[model samples]
Target: MSRIGRAGFKKQVMFVLTISSFIGALIIGGAVYFFETHQVKKNAAYLIQNTTRQAAVMLNDRLNLVFTQYNKMTDKTSLWRLVNQTYQEEDSPQKYKDILECYRDMKEIYSANSEIMDSLYFATSDGTSIPLYKDMIFEKRKINLEDMFQKNYEENYGYYWLNKHEDQVFPTRKPRYVVSLIQCFKNTKGEAAGYMVLNFKSSYIEKLLEKAQISENGYMMLLSDDGFLGGTHVEEKYRLSEKTIREILHKENENMEKEGFSIYQVPLEINGWILVSVVPVGDLVSSSRQFLVILGITILIILLIAGIFSLVSASMITRPIEKLTERVIEFQTNQNVSFPVDKNMGYEMRILAEGLSKLKERVEELLRQVKEEQEEKSKLELLIVQEQIKPHFLYNTLSSIKQLISMEENQKAEDMCEALSRFYRLGLSDGRDFITIQEEAEHVENYLLIQRYRYAANFDYSINIADDILKVKLLKLSLQPLVENAIYHGIKKKEEFGTIVISGYEENDFIYLKVFDDGIGMSEEELKELQTAVGRGKVREESNHFGLRNVNHRLKLYFGEEAKLVFESTYGMYTQVTMVLPKTKGEKEC
Candidate 1:
């Protein structure tokens, strides 16, 4: 045999191959371990974040439902009659009759959603606490209804949410913990008539948290500025510590990791409550540990095989290894590159290439999933904004209707109710996003009609659209908010009666819809501030220009950057809001 096939050549090749395989294994295995661990953590955090957000939305919706039910109940003529009746010092037949009627009404409302609610209490200024299921029963723990009203009703003008507490009003029943919504209603003279206390079952919220739980070890919790309200895990040991709660409350960051746990927090819009999701880091990366063990064993096996091959065919092995290294480098530089398996590249090389190919596919799949998730999140946010707008308008309109009924303007109230029905029917548009300009115009007309009844001599309005553009498609509720802003912020504030002109026209492949108000127009400073706010397209909790901001956001979302809201105002003279929409081809009603 030649010197190349002798002991010297074999020893040299074995040492070099052993060293190379060991180093390669460490480098590749470490990179994979880091990547896999990072991906696992990222996915866990994303899931937890979404869970917290969705929980908050669900809780908010439930809370809003309570308010909606409250509005409907309070709007009842019988309930209004009961609140208006003064409590006579002497027990009279009429007093008992009023109580009975009120109890029946409350019972009906409670029965509809009794699974979610514990009891409903309608407390009057005269110190009567009427429960839904039964008559007022005075127990040892007598809840002073007047004292409760005086303590909270005055501070919180409209409504407020209470923490979990024992059901004091219904002490005779089984001991049950509950969360309460306390709202005060006012009379025609703006004086407090009575209060409505709707107690929600705590177990219902706990169930919500349980349903929102992300993983076996991960759990969800409801928190407020004060502390923990409730959670999925009832055990003290399973619950998050006070320190973590405090940190979450004080920190502005929505997501944080502390004490081996990843925490995601979302604030509720209905109340200033917080929804929190907690997941263990160990649980998030538990699979990564198994992957690392398998990887290590595979690396050891590959190293042993390489050592054996080095003694047999060192040149062939080295050439293929160099080609593999070059391919890996190329892939590292450009992730779009594919690692294709070749029949001549040997079984081990082909297996490695296949692994690389699968990794690339997985990465691309994750990217696609992320993109879809982001789109869904945006759509959800838009839906939330739409929901927020609806409730405020409904509450205001219902209040107007209530006032009209109280004044006994039956004819005007009937007209307003009809207008409201039409307004909502068109506004909903069968859940379609785009509506014809004619339908949008009609929706705004109904809204204006309702406002006309509310502010009889305060303002007059006109909607003028070219006949040709009426069939063009536009976003639903696009003009109604602008019309509302013109009324309340502009016309209603002025001393003299003002005029609002809503005009629509098509010009140069774009449509211009304008709401012009001859009322208390904004000052230069105010105009600039309002413009900047809408330009940024972010909703501020304290801002009174939500209508304007919301409309501008929706416009930009659907119509791209070319679509915008143009504001023109001169202080104490006039304000005009023009919505610029890019006309889409083949516009038709849905």
Candidate 2:
């Protein structure tokens, strides 16, 4: 081959390579711009759709919970439970103190209406107010002539209203505004007991609607069906200003066939509610313009890379770059990359890039498999651990009973054995998280029976469960641990035959359980410490080798914050642990 001939061949090769490089650069630049733009649009759409769905679900759940809680607060059986306590008429000072403490507790539990609550208060039929304002307690405040209840009482109607009340405790005594939600409370005998008034501060509702996440340039407005706009995040002038939300609906198509819904109907399917969500067209356009600028910047970056490749086109190298593009596409599609022929590929390039891609694929597959295996192992371990704990309790109880039997204490031993059997049976029933109220009560009854032998004549139990509550769902051992706490901490040391009452009933849509014992109880300080421990998830400690911590943890684990163990104990007298459970449908019968 002559030098000129070889040189011409080389030039021809370079020329062909340069043209290929130019085309490749153009294609790659276009691909990058297209891929990035598509990703941006996809991400934005997904974000909007997911956020809206999540917001709806979260808000609906919160609303349902609030309604359930309110129902519990108004339950007929729960109210009757409060009035049916067997306190002595010739009561000691300690008895009065106990009653006062119980009343205070009831007020606190009922007052936990969340940050969005307007106001919550309990009023007796006699116009005595049990007001719970934040941490302050006002017991038995008599209604004055100017009281809001006066008009309602005179009218002989149970109704709520938007009104104001002077803050007697405050120096200003400025009449603060409130939207009252009032209902007539009835006893178990179907007689009116009192009027329960929940006065919600308008500001609280305003904050709730404001705190929720909203789309940019979007606003939330709440209005009554009767043209009364209560609150909104719109302009200050528009806040609380009455606007006919339904009138807007009527204007949309006046002659259209009317369904059950009003024209200004809220977007959601909630009952008796008007929620309006509006976003200005201008804001959407403005935001899309900003998105376009971001897209332009991405295009510029790709164009720069194209310019670099165009300048390098005269060089006869294309295989490495092409291989890299192919690998990237393979990764984007979640497919394994095929190995290119090594005829023109450099050994270093092949090992550096392609080798790493292959390694990543192998690693991902291995991780996925390992994750599944680990989850299975964890589930198995949990079951084994639970089984192990139960047998340990059962073995000890059975052994104690056997020893009693050998000592010719047949009655006590038989009772202990029967209780132990029932307890184990309840623990093993269907292996589900929830049981009926009767089932849970029966479990507690069995536990108390076992304890009775342990502390014979030391304490007596009086259980008063409402018939309506028998079908309500409750955590398996909700009452048992509380009862155990009363016995172990309150009555075990007392010489007298103290009374421990275990009772449960349904209120609006909640199951309320109370385990009370008239024995030696702890001071307020100790109770606070216990609460703090439970709140921090550090309920278990070496000093407290008891099941109360376990009970608190399990309650939280199952029912969230709305339902957990709560208690109030008076030193040297007695302790009462109360549990609140949401009414879950379809709980197993005893």
Instruction: Please tell me which predicted candidate would have the highest TM-score against the true structure.
Output: 1
User: Stretches of candidate 2 above 4 Å error?
Assistant: 1-396, 538-546, 584-590
Q: Candidate 1's residue-wise lDDT over 95-174, tens digit each?
A: 77777877876777687777787888787765666866443353545456456656455555577778777777677556
Each candidate: what lDDT? 0.77, 0.58
Q: Clashes in each model (backbone N, CA, C under 3 Å)?
A: 0, 7
**Window of ten residues with lowest summed lDDT in model 2:** 255-264
Candidate 2 on 237-280: residue-level lDDT in tens?
A: 33322334455434433211122111112333333334544433
Instruction: Please provide TM-scores, in order, for all candidate models, with all chains considered together.
Output: 0.43, 0.36
Worst 10 residues of 1 by lDDT: 1-10
After superposition on all C-alphas, the RMSD of every candidate to the true structure, in Å, is 27.8, 26.9
- How much is the lDDT of residue 60 in candidate 1? 90
